[model samples]
Target: MKENIHPDYQPVVFMDSTTGFKFLSGSTKKTQETVEWEDGNTYPLIRVEISSDSHPFYTGRQKFTQADGRVDRFNKKYGLADENAEK
Candidate 1:
């Protein structure tokens, strides 16, 4: 409620490189990079590696792995398994 006490809130563009998804939203984070949007307007551009578009959960490309096998492999490599203990 104070005057000039809050940081500037402006529109920002977050770009996901994996899916080429560009999203415009408001942010208070500071950045030095800028880019011209499709509408002939310039906004702050933030580059990211992943977003909902390319994420496994949202895109339904989730991978299933055998965790037990991974544990066995890790134990074999590091000699962490107890040889005297029952399996």
Candidate 2:
């Protein structure tokens, strides 16, 4: 452990601009913006384009693609689908 050599780790607010989702966490990143948190304390505000709140993987709102249909077509052409597997 060294003194005066590490970046400052402090409470910061990550805000998702698209979804307006705010999260409080400790980070070494600095920001010029400040936001008043629910605890009545001002913390550094970092704006992010995407977060878990708006991401497709986290929200499970991903677009349905034709890849699955293509896989079914391939399976049917190669007779890979087991009849018992369907039942």
Candidate 2: list runs displaced more than 4 Å.
66-87
Q: Alpha-carbon error at 79 in model 2, in Å?
A: 35
| Per-prediction TM-score | 0.73, 0.71
Query: TM-score for model 1?
Result: 0.73
Candidate 2, run of 10 with poorest lDDT: 78-87
Please report, as a residue range, the 10-residue window in candidate 1 with the lowest summed lDDT: 64-73
- The residue-by-residue lDDT of candidate 2 on 1-76, one tens digit each, is 8889999899999999999999999999988999999999999999999999999999999997675577688888
lDDT of 1 by residue, 5-65 (tens): 9999999999999788998989998899999988999999988899988899899999888
Model 2 lDDT, residue 27, Cα: 99
- Among residues 3 or more apart in sequence or in different chains, the pairs in candidate 2 whose N, CA or C atoms overlap within 3 Å are none
Candidate 2 lDDT:
0.93
lDDT of candidate 1 at residue 27, scale 0 to 100? 96
